[model samples]
Target chain A: MASTIAEKIFASHLRDTPTPGDAVLDIDVVMCHEITTPIAITDLMEKGMDRVFDPDKIKAVIDHVTPSKDSKTATQAKILRDWARRHNIKDFFDVGNNGVCHALFPEKGFIRPGYTVIMGDSHTCTHGAFGAFAAGIGTTDLEVGILKGVCAFKEPVTMRVDITGTLPVGVYAKDVILHIIKKITVNGATNKVMEFAGPIVDRMSMESRMTLCNMAIEAGGTCGICMPDRTTAEYLWPFIDDKYESVDDAVKDFKQWHSDPDAHYDSTITIDVSDLVPQATFGFKPDEVKDITDIEGENVDQIYIGSCTNGRIEDLRAAAKVLKGRKISRNVRGILSPATPSIFNQALEEGIIKIFMDAGFCVTNPTCGACLGMSTGVLAEGEVCASTTNRNFNGRMGKGGMVHLMSPLSAAAASIAGHITDPRKYLQ
Target chain B: MKQFGGPAIFLDRNDINTDEIIPAKYLTENSKTALKPFILEDLHLEGFDPQSDELKNAGVIVTRANFGCGSSREHAVWVFEVNDINVVIAESFARIFRQNMFNCGMLAVELPKEDIDIILSMGNVDIDIDVTNGVITAKGAGEKTFNFTLNDFARELIQAGGWLAYADKKY
Candidate 1:
């Protein structure tokens, strides 16, 4: 079988043929947030597996409930903290510095080009931006992965998404993904490996690439990846000093991951973003998206500008620019949460956060807060919202809290206007 | 106490997402107690207040398109089932949510928005789901009938009473 890129990553990680099903892949990096680790640690303890199967490969952070607002969140934090101390997790980050887990994991150089990475969080697909095959695993899967230090898998069929031409001005990476979801629906990518190609994807920043891969799960793909090049090296170099592996090794382990010039796909969808605007969800599905311009008078009570998707500095910058010198309207609650502690610190240094807070936005410490509807950002039964998070399912944020998923820029714009508004008004 | 498919309750809201179903925070430690309280909390802001006697009054939730969207957290399905909500009548459903529900033997029934609206506005009406007939009939309100798409696996799960119920037999 002519191995695909997904196969390459799997082969590179494969240790000696261990079991009938369990193939040990050389872990390039491991990622975790609070929720998955406590149980993993507990499982280990129950099994009397005191030490981790591997520590240097571990990167644990507390972002799911970083601020620890509720009793449950607080309990989760202490559990993670104690786990970090006991395991001596090298990349452990405390709450205040913790932003979103996936955002921080890559921003901090936990991912490298031509590497195989795993994260306990479902959004682990976010790491694919660095040219790694990353996917979020369930708790049982992660616990097993940590115990034996490898994961099992069947191969994913390759699917290519060709997004050509320049994406519109206000149309950031989020829109491209939303547009793809609109085409592919939610289950369109189910069980397929999507390698985003076309010159347009190459032009996108690593952060933008992260945004694309992050939402791959929304479409039900195991993970979405972009093959690494010089851009991958530039981003990886600053984040790590280690011999973070070489491209030659990458080429050796698996064939360079690209669709065969005439490669076949289970399905191939083309997205045209040149005319698309910043998109948002109108209801309980990421696929339930519409152009921001379409929802003119909808009453949105909340506007959330964070999550693994749009919780980066670029997201913050876009939101800040929209709300610059203006306050969120009284009828609207502008909620912002940065993705990582490093991203938050950088935002602070750049005064991006000041712009957001000064604009009357209620910012939460880095956690997957309202984006998941467990935070202060949830809406009332009849309230509407404009958010930058993935998914818009019923009761997603809080039942009766209607979600209108959009880009960070649109979210910020909607926050200021108290309704869904096009981000192009500010970005242009 | 009933397995009747119709007598739907309209929670006619748009964009009911999964994050709101079981927030990522609760996914931290897989415990029954942690998930039970927060059910549909994001769906309604108060979270799902089980103490409020929600489980006793089982009713159908009629929602807009793309209901139960996002994340494959079975917690979302369990929360609803434990709360006495067996039927999710939506114009559409996220594929994952449907799968999760089907695996657990929950009902994810879809119909046109117009039929859903008619039942909601008419109030307290009963309906019979005739799977073999490929139709759902409103109790007495002008004899409205609706069509739905029921996949084989989904039908099997619901017939089995949810994924746990199904797993018991399959395993």
Candidate 2:
């Protein structure tokens, strides 16, 4: 019987053949961060099950409200720190060393093809780009995963999305995903895996693929996966270097995880992006998107360029290309956070950091701040922001504040104009 | 099998996300009770005031599709649990939110759109959930009752009073 990648991974992990109802499958990685992991730790302690399945497989990081925002957030970090120490979890990343979990974990080569991963945060789906079965879970499931090295999931079903056309200039992966989300609405992929295939995805860089899969949850998808090819193998080559003779060997092994041509799908969608342009969200929901021309000139009080979704090194390069010498509008406050310390260091080495600062952008240490309104550049009441982060939900940045989700290139253009503007103008 | 239901607070909107159910700022609170007062604090539905007494006393919620659609935080369900709202009947629910509800020994009833239309028509009615029989009855004119189904695993989790108990027994 042929199977989709999701089904193949589930079958490999489960003790028996996978079925329709719930099945307990072994977990390969259990990711924990400060805010949500603390609650799970406290719960486990109360239940007297304060132990982990495998210390090495458990990666803990404090990135959400890092450097300790307040006593409350400080306490949350402290709990995670103590818990990591208790478990001898050497993979724990603390202040000055931590970045957003999604970006940091993948950068460290922690995720791989055909692995099963779970995290307490929704963006865990970002790892699905590696051809893994990754999903977000609640604290109860988190506790069970930590304790038993297992998680229960419904039988896997997949929705195949075929992108047939080349991405027009000025359109990034973020805009492509925003376009897909707009086409599907927010809940269209609910209860199913979204498998992105076809030429466009096949040509995307690993960074771009992560960006595409990161927003799978925004569309209510359990995961968004790309077939593991030579690009995927090269990205994971450094970590798996010892296991294979060459990248081609690794790709050959990964080909087994691909869905067979006759594999079943719940639904299939074909999107042609030959004429796609830069996109921006208009309202609270992510699906409320519009062509940049339709929403341009909407004045923004802030321009934020960072988050697990668009905080990687490539994202920085894209924004820097547009902001090299241009100063931001006086009315707009520009903030840029590279997703990881290594990315920050790379930007500094390449003079990208100087370009942003000279353009009046505030370059901060790696942290997932301001995206969720926890700290560092939060908007005031009634303020509007052009952001590279995911989710434009009302008050996502701060109470009564509005956010327009767009690509880093678009965000850079908006910073210069102090409004939602097209990045193509700056590219020219 | 157990029974849970009471006055239903209806919000006829789709994609009622976790951020609206409980804002992200409250996730740092030490206990689940700290989330109670802020339940639906950021929710922006017409004619629904966050400070309304009706919300405070309501024991159930009847809403449109995709209830709890954002964020993987379990706090969304905790807010409802702390406020004694043990059940939420909706057209459909996001996968993780529905599972979280069952993990906390609460119920998330998924009814079809047509049946949901009938229940939403009964304005401000009290509801009673018979978990064993998979039934929800609205105490209003016509006294209509709706049927919902739960998978055997969900029923087991509810009976065991959550995953921890179930794990204790099975693991």
- Could you say which candidate leads in DockQ? 2
Real contacts recovered, all predictions: 0.22, 0.66
* Candidate-wise lDDT, in order: 0.70, 0.92
Question: Local error of candidate 1 at B152, Å?
Answer: 21
Question: Candidate 1: what lDDT?
Answer: 0.70
The TM-score of the first chain in every model comes to: 0.91, 0.99
For model 1, residues B9-92, the per-residue Cα lDDT tens digits are: 556665566666666556754564456666665454334443444333645567787676556455676677666676787877
lDDT winner among the candidates?
A: 2
* Superposed Cα RMSD, model 1: 7.2
C-alpha RMSD between model 2 and the true structure: 1.1
Across B60-162, the per-residue lDDT of candidate 2 in tens digits comes to 9999999999899999999999999999999999989998999999999999999889987877789999898898889866699888898888888899999
Query: Clash pairs of candidate 2?
Result: none
> Scoring each candidate complex against the real one, what DockQ results?
0.15, 0.69
lDDT of 2 at A84: 98
lDDT of 1 at B12: 62
